[model samples]
Target: MSLRRRMCTVAAGAAAAPFVLVMLPAGVANAHGYVSDPPSRQAQCADGTVECGPIQWEPQSVEGPKGLDMCSGGNARFAELDNDHHGWEVTDVASTVEFSWTKTAAHSTRDWQYFIDGDLVAEFDGGNEQPPFSVDHTVDLSDYSGEHTVLAVWNIADTANAFYACTDVNIT
Candidate 1:
């Protein structure tokens, strides 16, 4: 082609590149699931119950390496979840609390685990099968009281990653 035509085409493509990038999704490209009920940190952000950064937009995208104990699944972009004093709303609950997950993208699961103060409180085996749109676990928190953080981990059966969520609760 002509030199002028080639230069014009190159410039046009360069001008459009930025727009294309902006139109694309950001944050975790594979955002999958997060605790919804009792409103985990991300859930609160998604529901506007609390102010957050990028996590506010993609609450279900808190995936990270397996065996992570903190919320945000070890993702720095979502470090806000690791902030214990981030003004996360504390839900009042009974001794028996049901933690639920809202899976935006279902994937084969290994098992679900719940921890309170670094102690394993409850767990459910997934049998290497994909979970439903929502999964619930009835955890007996009668042994603990007052405000506490519950870290829930969803270990995927197919991937070397897990989704993490932290819900603050004041058990009555």
Candidate 2:
């Protein structure tokens, strides 16, 4: 190509660089949601309440296959969440705890499941519809007491993936 043509090409590329950079994140917005209230492990990390790894940067991205029973959702990048002795803050609560979730990229949901000690405590129907930006579920924990880890799962309706978060709590 001629020198003039090369210069024109470079100028055009430079002009579009900013726009390209801005739109780059649009394609990586697949990150969905995570528990924010009662502060799930990922939530604590994201908010700096607890020191964690990459999960601190993208808490809403702890997504993996549905029916998972772990906090990190089987995502190796967030494996720190699976560590139970990582000085995670335990929220003190009564027999009932209302867990709240923040959805960054709201997708259709199949259901929301809460488990403790690997036992299902509550399950809410999502009706295969998109949820609100913030979702809340008042779970009854009257059957159990003392320190416990609550695993909350947001099962996406259309996909086989689910978002997972573990909340440490002292039930009084």
Candidate 3:
């Protein structure tokens, strides 16, 4: 092509460079990943039941994969909490505990129970048509101190089966 036409082509390509850059992934800018330090993976119990990490109260974000099951008794693709593990230190007995999770798909009903040092403290009821939800609970912890574990037992509402997730417990 002629020199003038080549110059015009170069100018047009330069103008489109910014748009192409914008379309590329801005890695690390908005990336979301599991909060677990060691990256918790799915595990199966002696009875062939799968469980996830011993989560703590630490502030972190995790993204659930597509078709992940939050229910119990089946081969769920996501992580489940270990009810027996506290996962953190308890320093303040009066501080309120907050627990949250996201569901990608809607469920008929979801129920969650909170336990502090193995004691039932609160319960949440997620009704039908609710896909993703969260909860914040404040409980008086003046009766205890030291390291403790806060467990969240979740299950389908009206069902006896349950799954657990945990966060580090500290009462100051």
Ranking by lDDT: 2, 1, 3
Q: What are the TM-scores, per candidate, against the unseen true structure?
A: 0.81, 0.83, 0.42
**Which has the greatest TM-score?**
2
Candidate 2: residue 44 lDDT (0-100): 93
Of the pair 1 and 3, which is ahead by TM-score? Answer: 1
Candidate 3 per-residue lDDT, tens place, 49-84, comes to 333332222112222322223322132322343234
lDDT of each: 0.91, 0.92, 0.42
> Which 10 residues in a row give candidate 3 its minimum summed lDDT?
30-39
Name the weakest run of 10 consecutive residues (lDDT summed) in model 1. Answer: 24-33
Model 1 lDDT tens row, 111-158: 999999999999999999878889999999999999999999999887
